[model samples]
Structure formats: structure tokens, C-alpha cells
Target chain A: MMEPSTDKAFINLINQNLGIAYKVSQFYFDDAENRQDAIQEMMYQLWKSYPSFDGRSKFSTWMYKVCLNTALTYLKSNKRNKNEPLQENHYHLPSEPENNKEEELRLLELAIGQLSSLNKAIVLLYLDGFEYSEISEVTGLSKSNVSVRLVRIRRELELKIKQKLNR
Target chain B: MDHLEIMRNQWQGSGKHAEFTPFQENEFSTLIKKQMKKQNHIIGRYFWGTFLFHILIYALMGHVLIKYGIVSSDQLVLTLSLFGIALTFPFTAKLMIEFKKLAQVQRGSIGVSTIKSQVEIRYGILSRYFRFKKLYDYFLIPIHCAIGAVLSFHIFVPGSFSYVSFPIISVFVISLASCWYAIRSENRTYFKLPLEELKGILGDFDKK
Candidate 1:
């Protein structure tokens, strides 16, 4: 049982870092309900594991590990059930009534959604500005593996975006 | 300049606009408690369900011993009950231990190695149990039936053991062959893909 003050502190911390949850959930789950469930599960795991935080790493780094792990587990379990259809390319078309920036961003999201789960994770971490070593640490991939994968992922994304632009 | 760079900037920028319903402290605490309760329910169900299944098996076996009274002596019944318990206890204990290990896995602050090890342990336990169960059904059940047949013939017919043995043996051979075929098909269809996926996940960590 957490003390009220500790609970409040934890709540504040989560509130501050909530964007990490949002971004990670959005990258993995296309639908709103699954995204919400993923976020809730992530927060619950973070709260359950909060007492183990030893201040050795940045809180965001620790949070990223928890979030990504939870998201991957969620995705796998959902796949087993095969209940909900995965929401691919659910974004508005480039011709929709949005500015070019929003359109391009939607295209990029759709393209990322097309990548394999592992590649999607690497690209998301890369976009979030994690160094290769940090990506390796979080993902359990060796640094060289992370480097090679990132180059391939970048080229894959470029090809995907180019195809989207042509369309 | 780069397409990827542009996407990253957009991610950082539009991420600010990702709307979420922020939870207050009390609400967050309530949510945490609710989730914890749900997790406890899932874990508790698995543990108790397994426990009750073993108990039910023992109860059924005891009922069989009482109803049949094949050996008119209480000592024989007690010995058989003890033997049944001894045979089943190992499997029950192992399942309980695996469930406990699964429950005790550190939730939030777990490292990659810890996660990988836990998953591997779970996969190993489950696949091993599946194979063991298949073998038990294929071999042990028929053997138990044969023993029961011989004992019943010895008690009731006194000299018809030879007569009963032939049919029992035939039944046993047919069932064993059929079970082997089923287990082989199940290994191919049910177990192979998931085990391969688990192995792939474990292999990711082994790369230098």
C-alpha cells in the first residue's frame, strides 16, 4: 500500500511523462480503445514496479522499457485472440482537408504502421531520439544489430514514404 | 531535409496535440487498485483451478476404489490411495511452482534479461508439460487399464486372465498407436509455430 504522498508523487510523475505513453501507444495500436488499454496497462505496470526505481537511470528511460514491453505483450496477446482487426492506414488521405504538414505526418504514420513489429519499434525509438546504444539497451539488441536494423529501417521508411507520395 | 527527420519533427510537434484524459490522484489510485485486483483474479484463477483439478482427480480415484471394492481389504484401498497421491503429487507441485514463478516476475522495473529468462522458463514449462501429458495419455493410461483388467480377472474369474489379457492388449495397442498419431499431428499443427516464435524471441538476445 502506498502512502498518500507517494501516490500523489507517482501520479504527478505519470502526468508529466504521459506523452511517452501516448506516443508509444499510438505507434503500436491504431484504434482508440486498444491505445487506451495499452496506456492503462503501461501505467499500472509502472505503478506496480515503482518501488524498484533505484535512480540509476533516467525515469524516462525506465518508463520507455516498461511501455515498450507492455505494448509488445499486448500486441502478441491480441494477435492470439485474433479478435479485432488491426487498424492499418486508418488515417485520412493526403487529399483530405488538412494542411500539407498534417497530411505528410499521417502518411508517415501509415508507412510506419506498415513495418514489421520489430522494425516499427526501432523506428519509433529512433524518431524519439534514442541513441543506438540506448535503443540496444531498451530492445535487447546488440549495438551493431541496432545500427544495421536502423539503416535498413530508414531505407524501408524512405521507400514507403516515396510510394505514398506517388499515390 | 530527410524524410525521416521531417517525420521525427512532426512526431515531436504533433505529439503535443495527442489528447488524453488526465487522471487525478484519487482516480489514478483507484485505477491502479482496480487493475491490481484484475491481475490477482487472473493469477488466482489459474492457481486454484489447477489445484482443484488435482483434487478432483484424487476424489474420483478414491470413489472408484470404494465403489469397486475389488480388494475386500481396507489396507489395500489405503495403499492404493497413497500410491495414487504419490504419483500425482509431483505434477501438481511442479505446476504450482511454475505459477508462483510467473506471478513473482518483477512487473515494472524488470530488465531485458529477466524478461527473456522468465518467458523462456514459462515456454519451457508449458511445452514440457504438453509433451509429458501426451506421453502419459499414450502410455500410462493404457498400462493402468491393463493392470486394472488383470486385477479384476484375477479376483472374479480366477483363471480367465489369459482370456481377458488378449483383448486388453489389443485395445491398448490400438489406442497407443492412435494416440501417437494424434500427438505427432498436434506437435506439427499446435505446438511448432508458437514454440518457434518463442525461440526466435529468445534468439534475439543471444546475438552478440
Candidate 2:
């Protein structure tokens, strides 16, 4: 596995799934610098954990698991200051929808960003089309709990998205 | 209707929600090299370095016992050194055992079927690691200091300066106190927050 050809193959596989890191980091970090750092850490962790891949699960599923786990464990560099009334990272719906479609997308991001860190991971999995079992397996929650949480999360998200849309 | 349908596109490939810069092999190689440097384990180095210091202290104490003989004026300090070595040896061994456990912890939890289990496993290992470290800091450091202070004072300063024996006790107190403060602060800075965060995450899981 340490051979040059193997390294190239591994790198190629990682390159293909690099989007997982990008998306996971986007959900996890508020600031761009921290997002960049998160991506690097996730990639490094993926490489380190690559040998244990076993190929039993789909590579993308495994990649998401590693990325989510890394993000969960990563200490937030932008943790709110106790005295500050403003949260620089806090999500806000814009006063004016500059462009209808972009605003909807932005609102979606804001609503999701505002979820609890655990919920963020859950919703990320759901929106990415992961099954209840797959989400439960990655999150360590029971299948029933995953179903329950997703139902609540979906309802909550839809309400927010619709209200923001004024539909 | 899947009102949340639009969000699926948001989470998937190369969207405004998720921006990706393709992987650069050179940047990754540099980062990988840096991580390789860290994988050398600074904590491991520190412990081994401390172990080397212990070896030196042992040699010094052994020489004093040989040079001064048990019945000499330095008998009291020799006996104290023996006591220090006895107490310190067990803690040193415990620290080494903890070190090995730490190595395993670094390897991280496997079969991460659930994120909760992974967090819990890491938390459990790290809490145990910090506990062992705290015990070593509180007990072993003081004992080792006493051993070193007593031996160094005896070996370097002969009978002519024996009247200054008060200084040996004073020096031991000062070193022990300073080390106590230093280690306490270090633990506070490094261990306190991470452990609390881990605990909080576990609590988040349990609150369900």
C-alpha cells in the first residue's frame, strides 16, 4: 500500500471525493480560514485512516464519515467571546433578497448553519441522500433516533425556508 | 412535497453552498511532511527525556551512597534520597504505562459505527490520560525534586558548607512550588478546555 503506484491511486480516489471535505467544512466552520484548516485536517485524517478503508462500504460513505467525525472533534477557533453581544459567525437572512434563487440558497445555508452541531451533521447526511441506516451508522445514533430527528429537522427547515421565501 | 428538495443540490457537488478548490499535491505534501514531524510525538520525547533525567539522578544518588557510606554525616540525606527513589520509581513506571496507553489513544478508535461511540471512546481514554498525568505532576515531580535537591546540595557542597543545610530545604521548596505552579497552569491551559468540551459533547448526546 506504501508503494508509489498505490499512493497515486489513493490520491486519485481522494481527489474524486474531495467534494466531501469541501461540503463538510462549509457546514462546520463559519470563517473561511477555519474552513480551509478544517479541509486540510479532514484530508490528512482521511489519508491516515485510509489503510483501514477495508472497502466494505462505499468510498464516499466512508469519506463522509471521516470528514464529519473530524469536523465534530475540531475545536472552533471562532468560539464566541462571552462578553461580545454580536456573534460574527451568526447566520442572518439578508434584509433584501438580491437575487431570488441565490437568496433562497443563502437562506437555506443560514437555516442549516443555525442547527446544533450534531443536527448539522444529521441534516447534512439527509440532504446528501444518505439513508436512515447510513446516517445512523455514521452518527452513532440508533436508526429510530435518526428517523425521529430527521423528521423534526426536516419540518423545522421547511418552515424556515418557506417563511423566508414568503411563499 | 419535498420542500427541502432544493437543499439537496446545496449539499451536493460544486455549488454556491459548497465551494471546493481542487486538491493540490504540493500543498498536501508540505502539510503531510509537517504532520509527519508532529507524529514523532513531543509528549513521548518529554517522557523519555524525563526518564533520562531520572537515570542521571539514580547514578548520582548511587555514587553518594558509595562515597559517603551509610554511617557518615550524610546518612540522613542518603536515606532521604533512597526514600525519594522508592517513591518516584512507582510513579515513573505508572507514567510509562500511561504513555503506552496514550500511544494507543493517538491511533484513535476503530470501527466508528457511530460518532457517539468514537467521541466517548476518545473522551474516556483522554480523561484517564489526564488523570494519570495529574497524579504524576502532584506526587512524582515533588519527590524527584527532593531527591535532586538533596543529592546536588550534598555532592557539590562539602562539610565546610554543611552549615548552609537550611538552603537545601529552601531550594527544594522553591523548585517544588515553582514546578507545581508551572504544571498546574500547563494542565489548565491544555487539558481543562478540551476535556470539558468532550464532556459537553457527550452530554449533548445523552440529553436525548
Candidate 3:
């Protein structure tokens, strides 16, 4: 029987899945401050649902479900006016210093920024090498629908990335 | 290379980092602890509230029966024994299940909202489903009423004597008042986060 130390167990599990939080947060917000908020909100959700994680599915799968769901919902519900510029702390892109990957990351970030929240999930899963079936499992999408969305997403991302690189 | 492949490389190369970069280790731990405590507090309220309310209901019933002499002293012992054995475990189990259901509902809301926006459908039926926390509250109400009924039985029964109007009326009024206050206070506190977050998010979603 598992001991009921929720705090200890939850913190450990979250630490293991930290990358999911980072990726989802990065995808959701351009500003550093907003990114942090998104990450924190995601943490809140994960911890709240920690008790129900029976471990039948992989931890990462459950986390992906939690993280993607939180990010998209948070984006939908974000009430801050777009007209207002982000405070310096809030408007930040993830840094990519000292690597051949910088330009690629910048371009990719731009591409993600252009997608709707749901489309972003499909793209993230696709980019992460999630097959249609796995993507459907994590996202609760039908396999056929996941395939269809990924096709559209590929077209959209290519156009967006090309425009960014050209600029 | 395909768009998906290009993104895969970029995402992999972006690297990984702690989510709580802005906060020091101590500060981050403290924050997580505070959040965990808050959740426990909410769970405790629901559990104990159900427990106490059930006790109150039986107390009231016992009192009325005893006053009428419809029940002997030995019968009082039997009723308590049956209630303790039969109801306690079921109530706690139900609360645990309710907690799980509540979490699922919350997750479901986020998932549905995300899918809805992506598919770009004009309308959806999610609003018809039970909100996670609201369903939790609904389940809590009957448990509380059952507890109150049990407690009332114990409290208002007139064993040796048989006059009931005043005591029964007062007991009912007191139970109703207490239940109302508890419901109002707890509902206001429990809903503060979801409603605020939902309203803000829904407002932004509407603008799109």
C-alpha cells in the first residue's frame, strides 16, 4: 500500500515530469513572466490530480495529458488584454545561447506562436514523434482526427516558418 | 525535411530546465507546500462536514423516538450500532470517489476547451455537463442531510416523557440554520478559484 504522503510523492513525480511543464509553458507564452505563470498553473493542476494517478499509464503520458490540457485552457481563459504590452519580465522567449540550434529554435518558436492552442498540441505531439495512435491516447483525440489535424498543422507550420526565416 | 521533423529537432535541441527558475529552491518548495496545504484544507472540510451532518440527523431522530416511548432504551443502543457499522465506511468511501470525480471534471473541462478551440467549431455541448466542483457539492449535500437526520434522532427523542412539538420544531429550525450557514460559507470559499479563473478565461475566449 502506498503511504499517503501527497506532498512528497507529488513533488517527486512533478520533478520527473518537469520537462513537460517547461515545453508546454514555452509553447503557450512568448513572455518570460507569462511563461512562468503558465508553468505554475500547470503545476497547480498536476498536484490537484496527483491522488488519482494510478500509474497504469506511463507517468509522461498522464503528464502530457495534464500539461497540454492546462496550457490550452489557460490560453483560452487568459483575460489580459493583448493591447497592453507585456512588462519586461513577462515578455520573454526561451533563450538559446551558444548553439547551432538558436536560429532553428527561434524559427520554430515563431511557427508555434502562430498556431491556435489546439493546433499547437497536434504540432507538439507530431514534433515529439508521437504516432497518430499515441497522440490520440495522450490527447483524447480520435486516431483519424489526430492524423487529419497533423496534416493541416504541417502545412500551417511550413508556411509560418518560411515566412519567419525569410524575414 | 518536413515541418514536423524540423520542429522535432528544434524542440529536442531547446534543452531542458527547472520550471521554477525564478525562485530559489527553498522558495519553490515553500510555494508547493502552501498549495498542497490549501488542497488538503478543502478536502478536510468536505469530509468532516459530511461526517458531522450525518451524526446530527441521527441524533434528532433518536430524540423524537425516545420522547414518544416508541423505542425502548435497548433499541437506542441497537440503532447507534447499526448506523456506526453500516454508514461510516460507505460515507468515507463516497467522499474519496467524489474527490476523484471532481479532479476528472476539472481536467475534462480543460481538454474539451482546448479541442473545441482547435477544431474551430462555433458551439459545443460541454456547458450541459456537470462542472467538477459543482457535482462534488451536490454529493456533499445529501450526505450532510443524512448526517443531520441521524443526529436529530439522537438529540430530540423524548425517552421517559412524550411531549414533542416545541423540541422538534426548534431542532428542525436549528439544523436548517446551521446547514444553510455551512453551505453558504463553504460554497463561497470553495468556488472562489474556479469561478474567478473560469470567468476570466471565458471572457478572453469570447473575444476570439
Candidate 4:
């Protein structure tokens, strides 16, 4: 078995990929606890499988696959869907920013979380600088399918942002 | 700027979300180590279980053969029993490697969806071995028992025929029940309605 990397190497990798965990968790979960649980689970799965990643793919690409797969399966099978929603008292979403850009960003996070798992994958890949071919490779979708879904995602987010802004 | 452009910068340079505070960093690494240790313990437990189970099976077979006087104490019942026990070693080693790989891949504690998606992609290969394990549990034991039943009946109870029906019927019933339990375990959650109206409860959070 391949030994774990030295602490310096491991820390470097963690610092690089940690954002992937946060973004993926944010996309899949609305509640902070769920997000944390999802992140922890993904990390657990990644550590479990990290050694055999034979450098064929970029490390980030492999990391994306590991994170997305873990989150999707967890969201699909988890019993948390049945838990009562947090009362309005539970979460302290920071006060809404006065600036339009920051408010939009905040709303975008919430809206994106509402997307279906597949759409979230498309959006995340697109936002992360993946071209159509690359997104297809990561997600097992055809390039044409990725393109078509991305159009739909853009339109959906536009409508959602407009409605939220007007309200 | 278009929404796409703004979102892209936020997504790409979203370093704040990705960056771990010192406390979170410590907690996550510790959790990963604990998970690895648990996996190693599970592998060791399975190894001993496989080794002990076959030994007990063979010992019982030996005792039966000796009591019936078909073979002396020094004689082996069948070389096949030893071969069957030998087969478990390869599986045990493969499981160890798999567990090791699983632990190493998760070193950073990334996120849940990515982890699950990776596992699903790899499930194609993993499922094959799991299927073999399920077969061993579901089919192998009863077949072994059936063989013992037939051999004892043929050798020691030539005149009695009542025991023959018990083995076939009992094995079939047990196998069916086990299959039913496995299917039920997979399907149990599909029946519940989830707490889908969280937005309504969160109320003004949606407005903000």
C-alpha cells in the first residue's frame, strides 16, 4: 500500500482542495450542519481512496470526482431529509449586505443550493473554469448535454435572481 | 457585469469559503486519522473471522467422518476442504488493500457529494467483489450443510430416510428469508415522505 504523503505535502493538497469541499457542500446542503456532515463524509471517502490516484488525471479533477460522488450518494441516501427544518431561530445567516453585488451573491448561494444535483454539477464545473469537454469528462455527460443544461441553468438562475430581487 | 461573470469570480476566488481556520483544520485531520484506524480494525476483524470460521467447519467435518468410521482419525475427509479455506486468504488481502486505498483517498476530508460520487463510479469494480461475498454468505453455507447431510445419510443411516427432507427444505427457507431481508433493507427508506417544506419553516430566511 502507498503510504500517506508527508505532512507538508498533505497540507498543501488539503489547502488546494478544501474549497472544492466547501463549494460542493454548499451546493448540496441548505443547513450548515448538513453541509459540515457532507464535507466530513467526502473527506473520509477521499482519504480512503487517495493512494491509488495514479497521476493520470489532475489532482483537482480526481478531487472533484471524489467530492461530488460522495455528496450525491450521501444526499440521496441520507435520512436527514426527514428531519424537521430548523426554526427561524436556529440559523443566523449574517445580515443581508446593502450592496447589490453582495446581496446577489448571497441569494445566488441559496438559489444554487436549490438546484437538482445534476444542475449543481453543471454549474459548479462551469463556474470553476471547466470547458464543455472537461465538464463532460468529470460528470459523465455528453458535451452537447452539458451545453444544453448550462443554458437552462443560466436561465433558471436569472429568473430566480430577478424574483428574489424584486421581492 | 453579467450574472455569469460575477458568479464566476465568486466561485473561482471563493477562497474564504474554502479556507479552513486553524481549529477546523485540526478537527478534520484528527477525524481522518480516527476513521483510518477504525477501517484497519475492521479489516483485522474480518481476517480472523474468515480464518476461524473455516477451521471450525473442517473440524466438524473431521469429527463426523471419524464417528461414522468411514475414515480413520489420520485420514482427511477431502483435500477440497483445505482448498476452500485457502481461497479466503486472497480475498482477505484484497480487502486490506481496498481499505488502505479508501483511507488514503480521503486524507483531506473534502466534501460529501464528491466522496459519494467517487464511490459510485468505483462501485462497478467494488460491486463484483461484494456480490461474491453475498454469494458466499447466501449460497455457500447451505451447500456445505447439504453435502454433509447427504454424506451422513448415505454412509451412516442407510435404512433411515427421514433426515433427507430436512436439509433441502431448511436451506431453501433460510436462503429465501435472507434474500428477503437484504431487499427490504435497501427499500425501507423509499416509503417515507421527507421534510420537504423547510422553506416554509425557515420563513423570512428566504427573503434575506
lDDT of each: 0.66, 0.71, 0.57, 0.59
Ranking by DockQ: 1, 2, 4, 3
True contacts kept of each: 0.28, 0.29, 0.16, 0.27
**Better candidate by TM-score, 1 or 4:** 1
Provide DockQ values for all models, in the order shown: 0.37, 0.32, 0.14, 0.24
Question: For each prediction, how big is the interface RMSD?
Answer: 4.2, 4.3, 7.5, 8.6
**Largest DockQ belongs to which candidate?**
1
Candidate 1 C-alpha lDDT tens digits along B1-208: 7677887776667666356677798778777777677677866865685577678767755664675544566454455555665666776776666566656665444543333453465468557755665655564555444444444444455455566777657765675577567657756544565566566666655644
Which stretches of candidate 2 lie above 4 Å from their native place? A1-6, A74-95, A99-108, A154-167, B1-6, B9-14, B17-30, B39-73, B104-111, B142-177
lDDT per residue as tens, model 4, B1-208: 6586688987677655655643255565676766556556755664565556666766766555556434543233343344434544455456556545533344334332333244443443344445555556555655555555555545554454574567545655665576557544533432111112222212211121
Model 1, which residues run further than 4 Å from truth? A1-6, A83-89, A92-105, A163-167, B67-71, B74-82, B106-197, B203-208
Worst 10 residues of 3 chain B by lDDT: B121-130
Candidate 1: the clashing residue pairs are: none
lDDT of 4 at B60: 64
Per-candidate TM-scores read 0.75, 0.74, 0.49, 0.58
Candidate 2, A4-105: lDDT as tens digits: 112666777888888788878767776667777777777767777777777888888888888987877644412422212213245455567688776766
Which CAPRI level is candidate 1? acceptable
Off by over 4 Å in 3: A1-5, A80-105, A163-167, B13-29, B32-208
TM-score of candidate 2 chain B vs. the reference:
0.68
Model 4 chain B: ten consecutive residues of lowest lDDT: B191-200
A best-first ranking of the candidates according to their lDDT comes to: 2, 1, 4, 3
Arrange candidates by TM-score, descending: 1, 2, 4, 3
**Worst ten-residue run, lDDT, model 1 chain B?**
B109-118
